[model samples]
Target chain A: MEGLIDGVLPDAAELPGLVADLRTARSGISFVYDVIEKLAERYELSDAVMVLDHPELGRQAFRSARRPIGEASAMHLNVLECPEGVHGVPGGVDPVSASVAVELCRIALDLDLYRHDSRHDGLTGLYNRRFFDVMFRRCASQSARYGWSFSVVIFDIDSFKQLNDRFGHMLGDRVLQVVGAEMHHALRSSDVAGRVGGDEFAILLMRADRENVPAFMSRIRAAVEANMEMSVGFSFGIAEAPVESTDPAELYRLADARLMAAKGTKR
Target chain B: MSVPASSEEVRLAPLGDSGDEDESPPFDALELEIRRLPGVVAVGWHRGEAMRACLSVGGFGLSALRSRAVQLARGHLDEPLSVELSDVEGVFAASSVASVRIIDILVAGGEVEVRLGAGHLIGTGRAGTGPEGAALATIRALDDLGIGASIELRIASAVVLPSDLGLAVVVSVVDRHDGSEHRSIAYASSVEESAAKAVIEAYELIGEQSRDQAQSAIR
Candidate 1:
């Protein structure tokens, strides 16, 4: 019988890898609770419950597997015997055990949330520079391995200082918000855009080329120009991977040089 | 003025009747002669009823030669030199133009000769009435200077003029080539007087070389 039950259960080895891939704290904890419920089906546990502990919300039960039994308390465990003498757990019972499971789930969820928040920008919701550095290195490595091209387009708001001087910082922030939205709209699903500095944004274009870069820049320029009320335009400098240069530092420097050249011709 | 009175002593010779075609007077020969002149570095010819030579001069002494050629030409031809100096002081005064350290002079034989460096900027706009006009005006001014030459002059250079505003003076001479000479004199500044004289001398040097080259080409 134990062998039959083991055969019916999902292979447990695959569950950990799946759980590790889920970085969202609540989602990860919820996923673990789901696996536990699936495991209980083969064993016919009288009552199975997974609870996650939230520091503020106390213990919260997230999942349960059970069968109804007579004279069980509203929140008590209902362990019933089937016709085959197998004990079955009623759903949403087993209050004490459920509470414990809820507390553990909460702890895991919180940790995942903490990790995510640490790596991302709170306002823009994009990966912060620290994460961007890691991502850039990873992408560069992949590009090197595959002999593919990757490009970074660095954009700066022109005369942002003067805008701030004339309209005050609050309006200046609104300008950034609008421009950021324009950038987001212009990027491809595969591309990543991040606020690398104040009034400066960086985008990573996977496998981009000079032929395509001008088009991309033109779109971004037109978008910003059309949407923003402020008298400003974005200056972009593109540096490609492995083609223009292989080193990320050198790529960025090339982009910077191009940007400076663009600025010289602007006015 | 105690200058030489004899024909041999004079560096300039009158524009004699060569009886050549009005427009095609063996320019190759003329260019060769102008090239052989000591101070004349380059020459260009234009074929018209009035022949002209473009003279590029290297030094100051060549200005005297330019003046003598115009004077001698006027003494022999039907129309002597006519000079016109235009208001081009601004261009003349620019440090960049002056830094070339060269001067361009236009001398008319039949076609006009404008001597400018490869890099010198000669204004050819309506504001300056074009290179041809400047050449004609210089010829008119020559007649005013009593330099006998039947040639029309046009001289324009990017050199500093001596005043805030410059003047354009035209002198017309009638029958100077046929010896029934009449002179028209119009004088403005000493600086212009010297500039016109220098351009004329440069032109003569160019003409002499042109004549020598023509003679050699035929030989």
Candidate 2:
């Protein structure tokens, strides 16, 4: 694909530098930004946004080049081999830019899948323990920087071991997958939930404080219960990051302790 | 703004024919047939989920209309848009814009169906003057396996430096049938060169997958 503009699109003399600029972007979001910014300079369009489906995050979009007017007739962001939606700017992407965009969007999608795999559990496809660690630390750091607290809830399925022993491992696995799916469906996209250990899950509710943790947890627990339907139950303990403790480890420890206490109280 | 306008009557389904493979309707032919619809300019194939129509962008570009299209697609269709929009756009851009109607595609139970819009159209100002053809054709095409399928593609990281000397691109491609993935990271003196090298490497990996599939079929 050397001299992509020249070799592929002979007529598009104006697209080489723009494609190169798009190539300079290190990630999908930045790629969208680069496309917008460079396109504005090259094509005289103002503003641009690229929206695509992300595996774990669902839908994600980025803005950079800025916009023409709202009346600028809509054009397909057909720069790549993706089914991505576009916003901002008008007229249309030059053919060569469209080619480059197609490849870039395809790459962006691959990255989303890669990130999802690296972070998710194999069996249940939920965020894994390692992802939990990373996200927890990020939440704590954000709390420190933003002066707001996010809540961490660590919970375990009641009698998961008993279920495994009685129903065998396959049923146990199904239970885990079901619970994970339920949790994913019940939680917001920004809220990250992970399978931390056998039968244990952790959720980080962004911008949530201790005061609202109960309502979120209660609503989720009920929903999960109804979804699971075989008399399944989960017990969780919530703690505010940076509010209850500044350290992510410390916050997790506190949440774990409270989880144990909650389990005891139930018993 | 040519959102599929829903008509009073929807011929929902070649229903209750779950097990009748002999009842295989022309649904298998819908892939190519969909493109010939009154307004469908292009086609995108994807794994999982029903076909969702993103509203037409007309002659302009997608930057303005994408969000509203996504929002409407989600509300109108039960499944989210899994097919890549860029590809669809590319297909249309590569073709003639003679027809005006833009129709979204759907597949199920060995059948392909296109729904007319549910009243409102999405996008900024007025787009093409052509009418929607959701009513034109019901049959959409399927892949060779009589299923909708899309290959996995991804861009890892592609970066070009301000100095104009160092450039790098990392790409990954996975086979949708199998979970195997190929990753490549290349560094070069130019961004285009790096991207080309990365694509080559990923393509090499995908080639291996093709060979494997062929061998498995032979066995």
For DockQ, the strongest prediction is 2
Model 2, A129-223: lDDT tens per residue?
Answer: 99779877777887888876688889888889998778645456657766665665556545778899999999888776667666755665675
What C-alpha lDDT, on a 0 to 100 scale, does residue A109 get in candidate 1?
48
lDDT of 2 by residue, B22-119 (tens): 21122212221222222233333222345433222223234423433343233223345432333233232222222111222333333223322111
Model 1 vs truth, CA RMSD: 46.1
Candidate 2 global CA lDDT score: 0.47
lDDT of 1 by residue, A1-267 (tens): 234323533442333343333332123333443434543553444444343323322122222321111222333432211110112244332333333333334444455345545654543445567776666776677777887778888878888898877764445655665555555455553566677777777778876666776777666667656766435677878888877766777887898888889988997
Q: What does TM-score give for chain A of every model?
A: 0.66, 0.61
Off by over 4 Å in 2: A1-101, A122-126, A142-147, A168-174, A181-190, A206-215, A264-267, B1-219
